[model samples]
Target chain A: MKNFDVYVKKQLLEKYPSMVFFLVVMLFPHFGAKAFGLFFIMLFSLASDVRQKRLDLMTFLPLNRRQIFWMEYLFLCLLLSTTFFVGLPFAERSIYAWLVLVRSFIFFSSYFGVIISAVSIGFDPYGAAFLFLLVDLVLGGIGSSQLGPTFNPYKLISPVYQANLLASLVFALILIYMAYRLFTQRGGER
Target chain B: MIRVEHLRKQLGNKQVLSDVSFTVEPGTIFALIGPNGAGKTTTIRCLTGALQADGGQIELFGENYKNFSQIYLKERMAVVPEERHVFRNFTAKDYVQIWSRLYSKWDDTIFSNFVARYSFDLSQKVESYSIGMKTILFVGLCVASQADLLILDEPTQHLDPTVRLEIMDMLKECASSGRTILISSHEIFEIEEYATHFGIIKEGRVIYSDSIDNAKENHRIVDKGENLQASDVIGLVGSSVLVKTKSDVGRYPRLNEIVVGYLTGHHERSLSLR
Candidate 1:
């Protein structure tokens, strides 16, 4: 499995330039507000590449389908965690900074959601990205309207956002588990 | 030894392999030959446990593949698949290091020697290597792993003749050292030279499987001095016959020739009837 890890690392390193660019943009003041959205998009795109390449290699090695799935999940976690740590030092020291970090985690979780949804529905990269973006946009719009203020943590603008942030984190964990199972079940077909 | 019994695999509506069964003896070279899209690669995938078969069983070294632990089975076998897929960003040395960790019995010295012998640059990224170079690298990795069984699908697909010969030599050396090899190739001539046992797959079925010498002897082209339809002549021969051609313009007028081909080439030794 060490060899397999190296293989995954080599692939991740190849895509490091794009990752760095995404991180830099997220750190920039002008783009900081939109960082969560961009991060969500980038995660799905990068995860798709990772999933496909790992699947291809699994075809050659004497590995079972389950091992391949777990390896990929582990790789995804490692990559996202590394990127998050690296970007931490550059974040601004303010209330918004903590919010940004929390939002970024939510964004990352949503990307996993996209990946799992894609696998479950057999959607390719383009379709998965489009679906994720569409869902996020609609959800964002709904959360901004007059009808949404009652449930809208964003409009409350203070302590409510913190509560929503915690809720979102919990929701993300649930989704990650669901996605892991869904993707693994679907991956057997490949 | 590797044994497959009644293995069946389906990809949606298409049945990739049905009731495919064969066995490979230790220290022998078993060649699986078939045309493109005949499920040769699919069969290899199933045997290697990369793709799960819908029905049937694969017993590698006495344990059923489905029941066997992946790490345990992997330690006993290495596969060089038809598609030469490798990490493009990794150098040759890096690639070898990664492979070494996968196999419990990897030999770094032997792998290094193979790299040098293949004339591959250790520092060059895998993406920089040509198709032939990539193939050589894959072959080298399989050989150096020192696994008991090597499963290669079209191992020499894109290699030049010289490189192909070198690979064959390497296979021969490995076999002599007590490693079993199962290879599939479209090049009949190359397979014919190296394979001790032959298996042919056609449309997801094992059409033929036997020793190479028996396959040649059992199937023979017989010339006759009379032109006749293939269907008409089929009843006259005791064994299965495939008619080469039926034409009336030859010097031997009314002559018809039939070529005998074996379905399995498993019959006992018989004296030449011709």
Candidate 2:
């Protein structure tokens, strides 16, 4: 636990600039633009570490792979969620607006989880970004009757209540859990 | 204490570590000497858990590594990876603070003395330090961690000759204080002067491993073309042949002789077979 704390603190200190930038970006009025900005901000923050091989420094410390992965995820969630929550009252008053904000956060987190996991397993972050774009397009469900809204990333942000926020939250948690497993299993190679 | 048996690793299409095996007794400096791409770094990576092995066993302190807790293993070991990387944005003081928080046995006095001896500017960012300074800084950190086991990969790569000798002496002192050291290096002459034991790796395989004294005692350098069994011969040393013999007929081989003989002999034999 001490090691975990130190790791979290180090990460926070190292990426505080990015964190501030993320907070500023979250203040953008449009939900779609905010969600889009959040995705890239989170990806670039984490991907910089992966691409620079900074994770190697943490691996040598007392912390295990699981601790490192979750610590990174924890900071990402805490920082981004805090920014979203703090800015909520000033931006939106209605329960429906709140639901839209929560849904967008959840969907983007789910996508971020997948991309981060791929990056953890040595995939190029730019390549994973391309992968995410493909998933977003498919989830847009453009003229596809077979592909439904159950897992559609577009529904959560569309503001039409096509997808349930609770269901999206659950799906996001599941994807995050899978990402945790994948990182712990294969993340130590470098 | 460390023991590795039949360890294997395949990176991409290359079998980086085909069958590496070695052991280091407590409080001994065991040098892992090998040529470039000979899998020395790969073996070190596997042992440090940075890379997983494809096959075989590794035992640290008599406990199987698979069953051992990595946190526990890390708590007792300090490693200086080959790259000698640092947090580019952090100052020396920041780096020390992080190390102190993470390592339970971190010795501030030791680190302070090192900083003082080297006159390192604590306020300057690590990225601004010269290559040699970065190497020195990590070496200092490894020593100050005060872990029971120290694994350094090319620890003295970027240092001046005088500092290299000083670092080697410091490592010698670390071993004298009952810490086991496993160093993977290409500095044959430097390591020969300080290492108590050695493992020579060639082509992803451990060709020979033994204590310096025992290796010298058991092997001899004879004139080339001496009548010896194929298995008894280790390698060639210029005009002489190195063979495992006990008849008191040939001069004992130096550490470099043994290493060069095995690496070059193996290379020649492989070429002849083709």
Expressed as tens digits, the lDDT of each residue in B1-274 for candidate 1 is 9898888998767998976889999999999877787788889877776666888989888877772245677778888877777654678877776677777788888888886787788888987888888888888989989999999888897899988998999898899899999998877767766778878776687765777765444333334554444422221233333332333322221111111133223221121122
Cα displacement (angstroms), candidate 2, residue B121, comes to 0.6
For model 2, residues A1-190, the per-residue Cα lDDT tens digits are 6776776667666776666666687765446656766676667665667667766677666666667767767666675566667677677577766765676667566766777678777787767776666755566554332356545455553222325566667777877787777766666255
**All candidates' TM-scores?**
0.77, 0.89
Q: B-chain TM-score, every candidate?
A: 0.82, 0.93
Candidate 1 C-alpha error for residue B28, in Å? 2.1
Alpha-carbon DockQ of candidate 2: 0.51
TM-score of chain B of 1: 0.82
- CAPRI quality band, candidate 2: medium
Off by over 4 Å in 1: A1-4, A26-54, A62-64, A90-103, A143-174, A188-190, B67-69, B214-221, B225-274
